[model samples]
Target chain A: MPIHEKSLIRPENIIRHESMNLQGVDVSGDWSTFIGSRTITDYNEDMQDEIAALPGGEYIHRCWQCGSCTNTCTVNAIEARFNPRYWIYLIRIGLEEELLRDKDILWQCVSCNKCTYTCPRDVVPEGVMKATAHWLELKGHTPDSPSTIFDREFSNQIFATGKVEEGRVLRRFFASTGQALRQPWLESMVIGLVSRLPVKMLLRLGLSAVLRPKTRKWSKSRAAITDYLQQQGRAERRALHLSAGEGTHV
Target chain B: MTHKEPTGDYNGFGPGWKATGLTPAEARRATDWVEAKIDRRALLVNKDRVEDIRERMWELEKDGEIVVHRIGDQHEPVVARTLYGWEKKIPTNSLWHHKSCGQCGNIPGYPSSILWLMNKFGIRYLDETDQTSCTAWNYHGSGIGNVVSLAAIFLRNFHQAYVSAQAQGLPVGTYYPLVHCGTSFGNYKEMRIYLMHSAELREQVRKILGKLGRLVDGKLLIPEEIVHYSEWLHVMRHRIREHQVVDCGNLRATIHPACHVYKMVPEDVIYDDTVMDGNRVAVSTGLMQTLGAQVIDYSTWYDCCGFGFRHIIGEREFTRSFAIDRKIKVAVDEARSDVMIGHDTGCITTLDKNQWIGRAVDKVYELPVMADCQFAALACGAHPYKLAQLHWHASPFETLLEKLGIDWQQAKAEFESYLKDVADGRFETLYDPKRAITSGPGFVRQQGDQAA
Candidate 1:
């Protein structure tokens, strides 16, 4: 008889013959199936340590595989493959090749923090997911995602002026992400507001767009933050065994 | 099929028959037991095992490592209980308005409603433009920023709040910070814990703050409590209800509690036994109940509004889908809510702005979304167009207004005539605009700028 829960085994690792004879008994295809030995040799042993070097990845080692994060994950409900628990397990075991399979959707973490909130062991799975996504981009596994582009656009404004004007951020983000400013839903939303908003409010919004809101005497704070982030970026690159100035834009 | 012969007690079943499977009734009981185990109240009770970071903050304060921006008698604080029954003193007066960038830029009504309500109560506040956005939205959306950057921003903004009163000839700490954005509320709380725990982090931010001259007595200034505007509305709900003119007893309201407000620092969020039996965070719900509105419950109360900082910008389809399906649809279909109330800037924007797009996919659930303060302001007889600024909202609030016995057409005409005054530069403001430029280049010293 076939082994119970045989589906758990990888189909690629299960060998089946069309027909076979076991001694005197003519055991057909059903009885001729055999389980193949499974072995892993391409483990990137430094995967866990490299991820741990990132900001959010610090507590990844604390995950005890209780699967609570995946169970309560917001993204997991929408996309079942966006599993934080499974990814953390793959990361902890140094299965870099296995992790690469889900690289595209890793950055899709909504940061709802439901995973971090429910994590029994305080693994902070949300942070781990972010670190892994960052690791992917740094190692050239993928290019900068649209989310990264938006974050950079938003953060650059704060680092420069200590405040963000939403209009400026939205326009710049759409531009950097190579998306048009004129999406159907976006146009409808703007029209809906414009139809009712007072002219003064509209003009004020227009004025803000012209002269972006900024914190006064923000030069010192901006300089300090730039210096700190650059230093942190250099340190993170070194931890990942990359040369200085690699992925500098990130 | 062959029928099994009846046995003594087993009835043809093997040993441990009870363990093999559950009957329908037994299965239901098991499901209920599991549900009860994971209920929010049970989860909150289990949270007691975690160390309270506030205890450590007090230790650090006593050790002279940090300065606590206390809620003094002047601020008139009201004590409230949190998830784990922790005491949090919410100041009811003399508040420093830490405005939200998203609210001001996206939904003008949000902050206006807040300021308008405070005016009705004659609450002392400083509506200034000196503070910066918490920048947590950027950090959470992108993996670029570290904890150090967030900590420095937190201290810088709170330091401004601490000393902002000095500009008005009042003593320092006169105005305790009242955070306007839910994201800022959550981010500041988390940053406070991080700053207290890591001496190294505090040292790093202290240097940055020192350079900016934001340090108080050469030490970082930390607030005793990070209070959200919703909490302020919650504590003052009864007083606000006394001024209520519109009867919302017929309104069915569903609250979209910001995840950042309660979930981030779950222990710090208010939970009253009177509100939803304390099973849910009580800020928005408490106010709605106090206003005599029927606060309805829905299944997806705990889900995020999909304002996933990145999801809203980069993967908008996911945001729209989640907002429409999980939030708006559930509130409309399950609760038949007249309106969806939210406390966070992003939640309001996402839920309100995304509803119009739902029609593209034939999923048109036209539910109006507004901040709790805006709704409260409307109930208290604030002009829907002038004061509450409902015109700035994307969702169709006309139906909601009509149902509440408000004349949108008259309000619109009045606002249109008011706009002519605005166009000619005759504008009305909640506070003196000169006070907005506290320390900026355009700052003009008031005549009575002397310490009282």
Candidate 2:
């Protein structure tokens, strides 16, 4: 947590004392040339193998690192580090280190899928970005992000009840985010007031978030679903390695 | 054999009633009439769809359905008791009304309805200046405007709202929480969350916003609660339900929640699909249920009402195709609901007003269209249904009301009184179109002239 003056000197660190033209030109000349030159060698080939294993993995090999995906990205316009162009370039070259550096950038995407929709050859750049980001988190190279939170708690909700319980998801989300215990008084007050309201009244106030009753038939299905996902993940990892081997020979 | 004679409130009692010797025009009027009479049947037949889905969504409801944490079902008890009644803390002093131009071009009174409701609740709000349209429609449609531009607009409006609220001694974002065009609210939330997700987007938006003014210390300018006017009405349904003091009697209304509001955040939509529970959420369906109307679930329940940004401006047919498949055909042939009640102005206009265009092109759907508020207002005895602005669709769903014995004369009186109270500065506009018009590149060119 200690601040180091030298930390400001990194290649990606472009100090902006004032606003600069964002039309691909830097009036401050602070645009990092190094962002383009960063080596693709830091990446492990296994990362590409892993990404080619997702639902929409066919589009992975289709990208040739054209900046069109990045240039068209609405997220990239604001968060430069969250560049699809750079992420795709890393995946293309297997630069695992650089990919991991900006893994948090993936969460910033609204999943509007605009990039995928506009892609020339229908390459799903968004999915590829997500696949690589997920891989980084699985390897412990990335920190917790919103998508991870949603995926974790949502999965837990479904995993436990075989269906999502809204009240549980929210409660877990709040507690996991450290907002639950920290705001104990607020929580208590909410509980007290909500408890006093009529059930019908609560539903009308958009409190359906907390009022969903449980599905009675889901208890037995949870074990089967969990087993299926685990088995699927192992099978996918094997298939990815085989595909990567084929790519190397080609 | 036909079971209860199709409830004669809608124009065409039920299926195949079109063959009943009524002329095509007469049949259209009959369909309208039949739609008016279904509310009486709801108390006996309607159930919340969420409860049904919750009961059946076995896989989706269980915790530990995945390999992550095996937190057992600890949240079910909390989720079962839906909360509706909240102490009325209406802020009428100063409200920073953010606007939407798309709603303005289509249905003008959506904002007016919000204002009317605000006055009814005696909540003080500010309809002030120096605030602009979130410009969300133009930006999202063009796919050119980035988070910076969006956040700048959000900050400017929130900043003005914050300052005004503080001037009145209220918390910054508390009193003036955003009440926007349906899509605008969804877009704002999406953009804000996305920006916050990346420190980079947050910093960039902050830099741009800083030029306008500081976000204020110790007070975040983000809206504390983003309220949709329909949701507000849904919350106050208990008080307003009794005022149905007007009798829709048996009007059959199919509630349409805007896709952007629910689809943009599916996790937030609490209503069910399999079950018919309409009173479980602050959504269109819930409000319709509260008004004592019958809500039918036709197939294609989740399809977009098809006012896709490009379709509305460039390709009219494409837009109609979405609307036809999603609303018109389903409302008539499948659900057999008489009228489609909409919560968003855009959806209302597309479903209600645009039907005539679809009809002229031989893509006709004979359903009366009105907003949930307009419908609620009608049920409350307010009429002429001022919110019945069908941009390209025909009007006079009067036949539907007539079938239910609702006097249009009463509706006209209620609507006129509502507008009168609004013009008297007694209400605050929740979804203002003129205000939305002020968001884009200065002037709205109305499809032909160059914008200034």
Candidate 3:
């Protein structure tokens, strides 16, 4: 019997989502802030080499903007505007603002690394896209991205406790991200229930959380970090003063 | 009629958590069953098992017993390493670089730090150029860009690198290789494969090249090799080891190879144990082992860092969900490692940068994430003090430093001293051309843009 097209394809593979929801989070700042800044041309030394060292740096220069990288991308299948070809073009053009404007798109990459996996030239587009996003963050524009909330709260908690206290990290993240707290009584009930779970489950979780390891205090890990930051800060300050761009007191 | 009449009292909905009358034991059993299924599925797809199976197949193929075929309709078997020999024989100089968008924000220091290290090695390189991001992120996430567009950008960059090299008195027809982010390295390799097989693509690229006079003397500008930094670093390992400019002392580290780099090119992976290695690849892991860090084995060492294309974009729940479950959760809850190290930038960002968020959502795991370099730097004593990135982390490296009884300040100073020493030639050069040439395998012939 002739196979039905529907039968030939898995029902689950059907694409049905409206797609907008899958797009990147919207940036809040004016696009103009990034447009004129020399940040686009101001590549960190070895930025090029770093890209070259990436999975497919060799073929990145081979792009002709045919959009196949985007056409074949699974992410674009879910969201139309999130085009990889356009971003590549933007980076190639040194349009720092355009790249930064789409910070959400960069983070939205699921990193299946499929584009690079599928890229004809071995461009490893995902890494390039990722590096661009990193550059944007250094410029101080955090995406209204949920992921950032977790990073910030986690860092803040770790800084305070010298170890990650999950319970504290969760509570702080909820508060910091403007997520409404679970009603006190509701939370209490949940905690009570959790406490009542099998001894093994609770024991495992509790042990893992408490045994959170700490860096040796004598290692002066903290001081080393501060010094590096200070040195980097000073260098950045000097660079800014020399370049005559707006400067911050590092 | 009697049954119907009795049912008249019942609500339309199923049991409202009361009628099933499940005992606590029953409830717990049901929960356990569900959790078991979850664990089972995770195990089956356990990234570790996947790597194991793939590695076994690789060994079989290497022994000429069987040939591995490419996935699905792709007629070609995935190309393993033809470039490794070339990379070993001739070192790369003056390359065109592409960037990764995601890592640009999260781990801002990866590229910068790598570049700084390269310069410290006295490697001649160029960073300035109008190079573009490979745009793989958007393409992978949005599916808007097509192969033709990608090839166009590929051609443009190659054209630029070739011209730059020519101007510098390098051979005019030479292929100036590119270093990349994410899957750019793999994608380029694939693109070359596609071009070799497709007359249409080759012709198209040729026409484009012709317009720009890129076909110097009607020959392709062959790039030397597409090298991943992990492999590049591995190549320099002996030298780095010999220099011994800094001491990392003692620390425990777990290495996470980028899925694109390791899983995609399983055979070519220099440290094949993890990708092809059982729980870990000895070479990559051995680098750390030799550094004197305790390496721990975990169940899900080979799982994707949740940077999978679909997970990162449309199915963030799955993306975030899996990342937490696979890497972050396993590292902290299972492996109990102090610092989770990765090879590539994207993995470093997702696994290293995303660990905190994973913990916040599920209150169990919180492991400090770092790249292999950062972790190695820690070991080499190059990173004397706890890095701010680590200090600001929930499981800061400071605690580890403290445990080691290290003077963070002195370490930091020493690390700085090493950097200066490296810059000032206080450290000896490890690459001896004569020894490398005599060892084995000279550089592979440059494969210019085959299509053009």
Best by TM-score: 1
Worst 10 residues of 2 chain A by lDDT: A30-39
Of 1 and 3, the candidate ranking higher by TM-score: 1
lDDT of 3 by residue, A1-250 (tens): 1112335433333222222221143322211011111223353343343333333343456666777678777788998767888877765655555555567666576677778777776667776665545444444555445555666677644543466777667777788778867978868988989977998988877786767656456246556655775665555434323332432222
Name model 2 segments beyond 4 Å from true: A1-250, B1-96, B166-174, B218-220, B270-282, B385-393, B409-452
Model 2: TM-score, first chain: 0.65
lDDT of 2 by residue, B333-420 (tens): 8877778877776787777656654533355567887777666665654434554322223544767777656666776677678779
TM-score of chain B of each: 0.89, 0.66, 0.63
The candidate maximizing lDDT is 1
| Deviation (Å) of B59 in candidate 2 | 32
Q: Which 10 consecutive positions of candidate 3 chain B have the poorest summed lDDT? A: B70-79
Candidate 2 docking classification: incorrect
User: Model 2 scores what on Cα lDDT?
Assistant: 0.58
Backbone N/Cα/C clashes per model: 0, 82, 130
lDDT of 1 by residue, B1-452 (tens): 99544333653333423443566699799879867765355443534355568788788889988888999998899999887667789999998899997998888989999999988999988888888889997878876768999999998888888888888888888888899998889998999888988889999999999999988889889888899999999999999999999999999999999999989978788999999999889999999999999999999999999888876766565567678878898999999999999999999999998776565445678899999999999999999999888888877889999989999999999999999999999999988877776665767778888753
- What would the TM-scores of all predictions be? 0.59, 0.46, 0.44
DockQ of each: 0.01, 0.01, 0.01
Chain B TM-score of model 1, please?
Answer: 0.89
